[model samples]
Target: MTAGRPAPAGPVWDRPEPPSRAALSPLSRERIVAAAIALADADGLGAVSLRKVGAALDAGPMRLYGYLSTKDELLDLMADAVHGEIELPLDAGWRETLRALATGIRAAALRHPWFTELAGGRPNIGPHALGVMEAALAALDRSGRFADIDEMMSARGTVTAYVIGAVRSEIAEQQVERASGVSEAEWRTATGPYLKRMLATGRYPTLARFVREGADRSAEEWFTAGLETVLDGLGQ
Candidate 1:
């Protein structure tokens, strides 16, 4: 089995047959997940009530209960569904591998901003999530230089947490833009004078410099710099 393969839920040979596209009468997990993803994409994660999902699929809410036990279960499935969208390379160097993993995760989170909110609500150890975890661990193992297993594990957590925190901040910024109709750059432009005036009070020259410099850094530069700093820290 591959390092990231999800645990055998059941015999592969015993897997249930998928419903035909023409078989409108058959309700399956894939259809249910698609409906949930659409509802989430359209209205955000909080809008994904079982009833709403069922309504989107033209089924009664009670009918969904037979397939998904509760809203939590549905969310778990939804989180995994979002994870399944991430693609990993079969071969890469250690830094390239880790960078790819981080980039893929960031892309996935951006594509499904709802998934970040779901992460807080659900205890997601689903297949795709496991695959991500396994892939990161495998990459570190293949690096062949870590002194302690515990240290390696801790470094991995730190790397992932930093990435997730950055992604969450970006998502929040985007959500604010959507709701308030203010571009981030516009917000910065509006606030910059007030912030600079406050900082010029001189108690925090370092912070003032950062704010000024940060204004000049493009979003990509900020993200790349942060990721590189984290990688450098891990090296030490």
Candidate 2:
């Protein structure tokens, strides 16, 4: 060292190095969103909160703020993560593509029932969500069925509306069954006598006829039938 220069600051050799601290699991947006999703899956959307998600991660609620600004933002992330579950077929026709997309979305919604609540109300701009939109639009554009982009978008919107509405209804029924601890079949059987009594009054002839004549179809059958009807209309 130069005589005029102060010796460079050096570590204290006599002192033991600071006790090694155990590494905490690293926090990330992915981990935070995943934790939030798990809470939503186990319970309903209402069960998920920053505090609870933080607790799941062994972090404080404030620690989540670094990755998420608000609960709505967290919800957006969760919705997109579920959207990632949808599989897009690359070589199918437009109608088939749309069908597959709708089916995939319905499956995802059933898996994460809260997803139906978040869907269709706001724009989902996350990459996975945007990929879904892109796949639909690209299929329509490639089909050459639309007069213009406006018509194409209208078709897409219509399908989206139908899927969201149908899935919401399905989820609502599932929730009702869960809450009542009664299956739909059991509920119908239990209420059949009362329904017959009410229909016997002759005020609901159409409903009575439908009740007697309507085919017993699974929820999947109903959903697929509705989806096909929508697609048929679009194909025209």
Candidate 3:
């Protein structure tokens, strides 16, 4: 008999029809996680309920229970999966290492804005998260300035904090865009009367000059400049 192909009396397709969940291979934890992440990416984390996730994966919500005891565990898995996308550093030197690490994490958060919400929930003590931290800390350790573990940990904290702040700023920009329905430039224009009113009061001469001289500057430019200043301070 020909392998896979149906008999002469049957359909020509060799493959069996994909089965319903009742007859299908059981849904695994990995399948649940991938579905949840897809849901998050498509419709934000708020849309990633158990039922919705299961629907996306073609499995019953009850099937997810076998893998995840609660939605929280699923969230944890989702967060770790996002972190996994942040490829670990393969090169040396603390500055290069820190820059690459921070940039990669920032990109990941940008890719999945929901990850930012997960960052504050728990100490990411999972293997994947731990390994990322360890890689970064190890690079910093090679610098030898951090004689004490606390100091090294603090330094690591600063870098991660910086990335968190950057991601939050990104989230805020999206929120502002939705709420204001105006570009930053348009916002400045719209708020000119208020800015002028404050400046005319004579209490904000410095701010007045700044507003006058840099009225055309974009909020994004200001944010980037501020972030660079922060990184410079951390490097120093």
Number of backbone-clashing residue pairs for each candidate, in the order shown: 0, 0, 0
TM-score result, candidate 1: 0.83
lDDT of 3 by residue, 1-236 (tens): 32563333322122232233554645766677898998898888889889998888777877665555557767877888888888788658776777777777877887888888897567776567877888888987888867777877888888788778877887778777877789877887898889788789999888888876875645455545655666577567
- TM-scores of the candidates are 0.83, 0.86, 0.80
Give lDDT tens digits, candidate 1, residues 1-236. 32563454442223443434553445777788889988888888778888888888888876665465567667777888887777865556556666777778788888888777765453468888778767777777778767777877777777777777888888888888989999988998999889878998998999977876756775556776788898888776
lDDT comparing candidate 3 with the true structure: 0.74
lDDT of 2 at 127: 79
Better of 1 and 2 by TM-score: 2
Task: Give per-residue lDDT, candidate 1, residue 81.
Answer: 82
Which runs of model 2 end up more than 4 angstroms from their true locations? 1-22
Better of 2 and 3 by lDDT: 2
Candidate 3: C-alpha RMSD to true structure equals: 11.1
Which residue ranges in model 1 land beyond 4 Å of their true spot?
1-25, 120-123
Per-residue lDDT value at 159 in model 2: 97
- Candidate order by decreasing TM-score: 2, 1, 3
Give a tens-digit lDDT track for model 2, residues 126-226.
Answer: 77888999899999999998999999889988999999999999989988999999998899899999999999999999999999899899999999999
Show model 3 residue runs off by greater than 4 Å. Answer: 1-22, 212-228
* Residue-level lDDT for 176 in candidate 3: 76
